[model samples]
Target: MITRIATLAAAFVLFALPAAAQSLAPYKDDLFAYPATLSEADGGAYRVVDYREMRDVNERDEVPERRVRKQYISLGVRSQQQEMKLGTQRFVAVGTQQGASMIVLYLHGQGGSRSQGVNDFTFGGNFNRVKNLVAKAGGLYLSPDFTDFGDGGAAQIGALIEHFSAQSPGAPVIVACGSMGGMLCWKLASDPLVAERLGGLLLLGSLWDESFLKSPAYKRKVPVFFGQGSHDTVFPVEKQEAFYRKVRGKSGNYPARFVRFESGTHGTPIRMTDWREVLNWMLKS
Candidate 1:
């Protein structure tokens, strides 16, 4: 049965990839036309852009006039004299403006920036819709660019949580990640500090290998929502199901839920919408 499911999953992946590519072609140009300048509240120079505006530009073929209500934050440490230089990390925070009810920390997939799987700086048209949805749901969205293309471990995510918590106190935090970020979420949820502050976790298209989940220190107590494409090529259905089974066995009363989208491919539109469902679940939780 597992072999049959795997073969069918492979076929679905093959069929879904090219169809997704064609659907994404129309909004490709809005990715890089973001606004060039932003003045921070602390009198610092920061570049800001509305990812939704970029998407509108892609769909309409022109940059739309809109107020710059939110700013994209770039966080990193630069080398000083006789010190090694770590590369800068880029992240976008939507709902940083007033009236945000909660704070959400987002980690993107492999080779994806802190935009949380959306490339508004390149291809536009509702690319960053999840962030906007969180904001509309009265929450602040915080995403961080991890070290080495999101290959950074739990420490990076922890640092981002601390920084955002310091910036906005008393706001409940929810952590969300996709693909490699899902692995990071798993690692972070195990930490006591993270567990103390985190209200929920959302994992999208996660690659949670069996060995990783079986580790002794990887117990997660918070509610977790996991969504994946039924046809993900990178992480097949059998592997995902095996990982889910392991997690279910290891954690007691973990409140974990899984949804598999039919005919979905890795990093495709269906995958992106699955993320939106994750955000919705987080908000309700």
Candidate 2:
């Protein structure tokens, strides 16, 4: 195991500079990046993104849900939809399986599965962009099937993190949680072991937990990115904004960010969050 880890570390060093010292190499910024930033604060950590359904969704997709074609997906990346078992936990990993310099895991919301995170053409192909970015950057992306959103599921996710992290010893693990998946994110944040492994947390159109203010991850100052839609009916945006303010108030220098998509709905963040920009910020935080 030690020899394998050493080999992975060597591979990582050759892949790119240490994650802390550099940002992710650009993938397709011209196509996948967010539109004009309406406003920003706290050194650009907090901002409002101008989101229009006509441009962000209708124009980008050839047929909305049915197809996005070459504009959104690159069929070349090695995105294996197969399952890997860690004890009893199962997951679908996209990108390099071993010797990764960075690790990203997307936890789907209620009514979503492990497949949701790896789907190339869905969610405006945001997931596909993430797959390509990590692969090109020599990293790993995981979409796991968990039992529940409570302790059991968080433990399952934590175990997966431990297993992959062992393979890529120093790789930073960033968990991007959507909607109900935020429950698991908060649970993981409260766990010291998982918290130690986390480079950051991306809450996309997700709920907030007041308890997070006292979590181990918070104490450790783990960077956090909150992307929400201003018009979200489920999990009101105002409440989320209040929470972001509290996080900032708690620590004047905490590595945290909030991106509000004006006039967007509940699923807007998943479809619109800029993976490259946010992940780079966390890696360099």
Candidate 3:
């Protein structure tokens, strides 16, 4: 069963790569066509990487290296102290292992809870394939319940970022926000501390808010993994691509990838192996 799933995941990966490169080609000329006076290195623009190359890199033959068997262990009852509380909130840790060097914080969507996030992020006990990659590299995963909706929840998310960052000083923090969680993620990006601490951002079925996108802190070298569904009713691929173009317009060499899931809805993109692939990249790349 695992073998079959792996095969299917590889197939999906092949399909996802095309969307990464093709999504913003046409907009490049109109969006990033600056005069020769402004050099790309001077923050004008940088050549967009060919997404197909990622596929080639994955195809290379590799040694049979030892891997940490991913185990979804429960890390007991946890809660946010009143001072840091954005509102009544709690969280649960789910991953193959735990440590300080690398941490992944997944923010749930509107009305979403850790219960739903755990099952969704882990694909209901199939275990994240990337967990081994992360564990071997020394990292853990965290999923939190955002009872506070809208931008009001940003502070709580920031508090969590602060907590984890403080726990592991100098550790790279990666935030994977889905749907409404993306809103809070953007709000957190505006914060100099949170923006400085983030190693990467993953937008799953979420749109970009230009308010923070154009900020200097956000425009830094932090990588962004954008996952979108062609069939997503709330926020379609068009919106994701538009956001990508907007960001790419300002920062040419920004490490942003658009992973498209064909015929997928709002939730399906979150259920793929892509999450682990991107998470590992954010941590180990």
Candidate 4:
């Protein structure tokens, strides 16, 4: 049964990759791109990025958590904030609705709502950049609100993916989970259906699951990107880095990448992650 599932998983990923070839169009390439890299390892699969609060936060935000530079946002993107009866869940949808070439979904952490992923001003306008990239590349971007970070929430997100994916057949689904939202990411990975549709998994300032080694997504070779902060207090960076190393070693060098933000804290990865760079890599892989 395991071998049969793995074969199907690989077949689905291969089918999904070709449609995701068109890379994301540039949007504030100079401003949103990652800054200087501090170090690199494992042939560039791992990197340490230079991050400073004074520059990445203070200089970018006008009121810390309230607002950001006006230039960082492009309000013209056609985004619809609505509720879907699929699971009675609320979500913010951006970019093309039908026949989308790709699909990107952001699942926010605990104490956050669907709006957090669509906030153009906060998080150094990182969310705004993703919206523009998806819109220009003929893709769909969704940020949804779920009941909790458990099986119930995973079912809600899975239903959302199935509904949108039906509208845009063969579009690769790349899920990005922040903080506690990683719980759903792992759960989705274990789900055979969701695992088959996934192009990649982005764990931003999130946790790890040991069972992932035996998950269908692992057998499918779905790419994974980990963004961590060296100084994160909520979830220690060491544990995540250790798990990342284990994943690479266990999978004989899996399609996984890690980016460590030197001196950054819990929310730094959410604010500093280069969505274009990460998404493009997964699309091509």
Q: Rank the candidates by TM-score, best first.
A: 4, 2, 3, 1
lDDT of 1 by residue, 1-285 (tens): 001111111111111111000111122123323223222211221112122323333343433322211222111100000111122444555543233356677677777765433343222233344444444444556666777423365776676666656555655577777676777776766666766667667666677745445432345445566556667788775677566656655533444566554445564322233344344444444
lDDT of 4 by residue, 1-285 (tens): 001111111111112223445788788989987879999998899999999898888888888767888988887663333333453577777766677889899999999998899888899889988988986787888998999999999999999898888878889999999999999999999999999899999999999999998999989989999999999999999999999998787544688999999999998899999999999999988
Poorest stretch of ten by lDDT in candidate 4: 1-10
| Maximum-lDDT candidate | 4
Q: lDDT scores for all predictions?
A: 0.48, 0.83, 0.53, 0.85
**Which structure is stronger by lDDT: 2 or 4?**
4
lDDT of 3 by residue, 1-285 (tens): 001111111111111111011111121122112112212232322222212212211221121111211232222211110111223556654322213556677787877776554441243221233333333344545667764756557777787777666656666778888887888777777788888888788887887888866654566757777776668899877877777776655545666666665555676455432444465456443
User: Candidate 2 on 22-121: residue-level lDDT in tens?
Assistant: 4678877888788899999877878999999988888888888646657777866642334566766667776566667788999999998888898888
List residue ranges in candidate 4 displaced over 4 A.
1-19, 78-87, 250-252
Model 3 error, position 6 (Å): 33
Compared with the true structure, the alpha-carbon lDDT of candidate 2 equals 0.83
Quote the positional error of residue 117 for candidate 1 in Å: 4.0
Q: Which residue segments of model 1 deviate by more than 4 Å? A: 1-88, 97-100, 115-127, 149-153, 209-220, 249-253, 269-277
Decreasing lDDT order of the candidates:
4, 2, 3, 1
